[model samples]
Target chain A: MLENKDPNRTDLRELGEFGLIDHLTQGLTQSQPSTIKGVGDDAAVVDIGGKYLGITTDMLVEGVHFDLGYTPLKHLGYKAVVVNLSDVYAMNMQPTQVTVSLAVSNRFPLEALEELYSGIALASRIYGVDVVGGDTTSSNKGMILSITALGFGKPEKVAYRSGAKPNDLLVVSGDLGGAYLGLQVLKREHEVVKVNPAHQPDLGAYHYLVERQLKPEARKDVIALLEGLEVTPTSMIDISDGLSSEILHLCKSSGTGCRLYEDKIPLDPMVISTCEEFSLDATLVALSGGEDYELLFTIDQKDFPKVKGNPNLTVIGHMTDQGEGANLVSRSGSSIPLTAQGWNAFQGE
Target chain B: MLENKDPNRTDLRELGEFGLIDHLTQGLTQSQPSTIKGVGDDAAVVDIGGKYLGITTDMLVEGVHFDLGYTPLKHLGYKAVVVNLSDVYAMNMQPTQVTVSLAVSNRFPLEALEELYSGIALASRIYGVDVVGGDTTSSNKGMILSITALGFGKPEKVAYRSGAKPNDLLVVSGDLGGAYLGLQVLKREHEVVKVNPAHQPDLGAYHYLVERQLKPEARKDVIALLEGLEVTPTSMIDISDGLSSEILHLCKSSGTGCRLYEDKIPLDPMVISTCEEFSLDATLVALSGGEDYELLFTIDQKDFPKVKGNPNLTVIGHMTDQGEGANLVSRSGSSIPLTAQGWNAFQGE
Candidate 1:
């Protein structure tokens, strides 16, 4: 039996998500010769003979990650799979297979699960990954979905979070802040519906933001594009926890600092307009509003010519020596220290 | 944006766990050349060059799969990893890596999670598997643990559930029913403690059963023993959902029926005594008591000589023609049809 009244118990919120992970996994030695990298990357890299296998897992809880009041079961399932595939893609591997596990309460009917599975099936078909194996069980409350994605690549081509070097050009794929803005629109509409059951609010103006939040895509195409252009990222990570947080991750892992330009941060017109309507700073939203699911990487300065004119790729900044520290250059020309404002699940609601 | 008042919803309990999986994954098509087998097996088989890779996942939810009141955090963590590894071992593969994902509410303190992770670390060390990757998030209610295990084996040496043929001897590693009996003893003791909070039940008499319930091990040693003896099973599966349910799974996949001799069922002395004290039928307990975590396989009659006198294995039955149907040959010389009485998570508690 466990002691429920321990006086020495430390609150989980004190350490936050990343701190808890580090503290819990400290000194975990790997004995498998095939394990090339573990725990500290977007995906774990394992050597399967001559090739490299990338494995990663992600979990999404109903209340913490999404609200069924606005999020459909199909989209939730699709988003769950995409988020994990994004990790594999961040590792610069070709996504091949996934295992999906779900724990749901009795409130979810058979038809609801069917809807969820359909979205997973759609993602599998679109991404060309086989749904290999999984387990399903009942939970006492809301649904919890956990997905593990596996991908393969050449051992030499496998990218790690700790491979960045000073003077490398920092780049990101697609836009930022749209997914977070979309979530705001959905949550607002959900509150309105709760007060007025028959209300049907028009969302045409927020279409892009809503879609970005509900159906954000992983950057699988970016991996292929980089290969076609003959450019390999020195280090890469998926932007799930906002731009500033990811930049900090790359910096910490690679032992380098970065200088991100505020003007260079990509944002869709809808995201910009939504931020104005909500009276929020667009730059701050891009910096700390998580769940973008875009690939952020660094390329050698010499290789910049290959992606120079690519519309899908944007050069936002450059890596600096670790002693310089991570910072953002504001539009007013002042440099400010970058801090991780990423979503911490352990924080009290 | 979603309709919660749908009148056409079907209850999940209608189809049960296996039926739900079958229904959800009915038309999934695998386009990957490396995917040798997908779904409907203990673990998915993937061809990574000349070798086979095994991928499997399992989820454990609080109140459904386990209760923290009677289960120690360390044992819970260890059991979670062992359950997934059992599937890989059933496929005749050597587990090399695992990804453990946990979603816990703020109710769990940092110290509590450390105890859980310590158990997981111990299992990883003993099982010789690298803790490659995982995701941690906050759940709305209780804790949910999802683990994915990866293993490797020679393509030719890999065993499948569909490989059994007529006349193959059905063999099981270790004794049956102990784990189930162990759970019963724990539940009984738990009830006693609940009625009198200060009472500490002496469980010395039920030590073996309690250990079996609290710390069941996957038969990785049995896999090695089979290899050392040069015995390749015609078919193999792990007994997680009790003997009858697992036997049915093998029969369904292999397209054969089996003649399971009730008298031949192996039971430990403690299991039998515990069953007697509990006023439960030992045969029924062995038939439907789940979570045994023992390897069950079919071997050719010629290879039976290799394991004939092995203390670790017992030949309890023989595969029969599909027309024979699955039956239990009772010690009284009467035949009875086998029914799956495995624990279905969807069933009402």
Candidate 2:
């Protein structure tokens, strides 16, 4: 039991997600010379002579991150590793090893674990990262997965969130809003199935969106492409918490502002159709919808010629001075303030 | 929903803890040049030129690792960090940074998390390790804490479980069985409280044991002391799953045998008295009771004199030829085979 030392217990929601993290981590000191970067980054950078080692961790709780009714165990495991690797890639580093810790209840049998591990093995094989170590134990409820990914890159090559400069071109890899729309479809179908177990909903139309939600891949190819094109990003981050939130993080950390052009925002045709079907605004969905797992980065204006015609790359915005603030310039010529509607599992959403 | 592809499903308990890990990790290949060790060590070693970086992870699930009714959140936080650090210490390395991830239910408020972080911060300050990064999210059920500790040591200074040789002196740091006895005392008191809420249990008699269970510290001192004594253990492991289990692990990994003297096992007077009070065998309790968090190591016979007459170090046994097998020489002059009845959380015990 614990003694209530504080008479007024502050609710977690009152602090929100980022506020809570900042409050708890304030005044924390790094005591290691190897620790080049501690918190407030895509991954903590450890100086290891020839290159810096980027370390990052993420936890996925069942029911909060996924619904078992629709999520396959193999996909859950694969996505768990991939999401953490995305953070490493966000640092512009090559992931080398990972530690996967799992806590599961008795409901999962050995075969279920094998399927989960098979997915982890598949990810490791494809990502060229070694499964170095982990801890497996029993949980009181459902499954919880925590993955820590380690990566490395030269000091000059690795990107940080605070490196964006004024006038830097903002770029994003792939389309957005698909994962969120896919989740909405899955939830709707789940409700339908609950009402009638015999009902088999048609999902062929939303195949691409659903796949983006279930099996999102890290932009390892983008990193390699940048190297081949000799274009290094000034600032980079993985788009896990929606575009608005991630861009705000870059702007806040770099002491700059951004103006995203709504006309240039990339969206797959399927994403637009799904948004229309669901009666959701495509622009709003693209701005606030999370779990895209795409790479959002900023590059110098000099590198524009290298990435201008690349099909995988989209120039959506540019950095501005700190006084301008983060905004989205609409196609109608109206400026809208960007807000972070990032998904917070703590709010029980 | 998931379709059962396998008709026959095996329970996790059938495979036991180690068997399940072995089955899941079988045929896993390491392809990274930076990865020196994977899967089967106290910590995974990564090549970093001047020194090797050791990374290890451990997860603690509520209701499985600790009972919140008897465990304080602050102590739980401290113990969670310490247990993972013990793994890093087991490799004979100095821990530098740690990443902590917690999946907690909404039952806990911001103040509760602040208390938990306070304990974590205290441990980091005391151990001289930096809290580099962590993920804090919501869990569907109870709390789950996962910690990844990073450390570094010279290649020659790092000790692995497979490095012990025949005739090496088997040594253990501190006393065993106190933490297990401490848990027993707490559980007994909890039962009393459940029967009558007004009952004030007298815990003064089991103060040492209670403290051991509530706040077990890793052997950071032993690592420093060994260095001071100019002693490099041939093989080392932390006694997390009882003395017999750890001895067996060392023997199994090193491909050797061991002979432990029953009288040589260091035990506090309180452990002997408490074992008598509980009508339990003290020798058996010391042999099989887990969570001691002491260091179990092997050193060359030439280093015996250096460790001899040291109160903190106990020469419990010696490594023998592979064919000899692992045995415990009882005070009655009988040879008893050691078995690993170590705590398996997956068994729901």
Which 10 residues in a row give candidate 1 chain B its minimum summed lDDT? B1-10
C-alpha lDDT score of every prediction, in listed order: 0.92, 0.90
Pairs that collide in candidate 1 are none
Give me the displacement of residue A52 in model 1, in angstroms. 0.2
Q: Candidate 1 overall Cα lDDT vs. reference?
A: 0.92
Assess every candidate by TM-score. 0.99, 0.97
DockQ of candidate model 1:
0.75
Taking the tens digit of each residue's C-alpha lDDT, what string does model 1 give over A126-158? Answer: 999999989888888888889999999998888
Tens-place lDDT digits, model 2, residues A1-349:
3434465777676777788788888857777888888888999998877889999999888888888988888888899999999999999999999998888777787888888998899899899999999988888788888999999899999999999999999999999998899889988998999999999989889999888888899999999999999999999999998999999999999999999999999999998888888999999888889999999999999999999989999999999998999999999989988988887666743
What is residue B262's positional error in candidate 1, in angstroms?
0.8
Error of 1 at A323 (Å): 0.4
lDDT of 2: 0.90
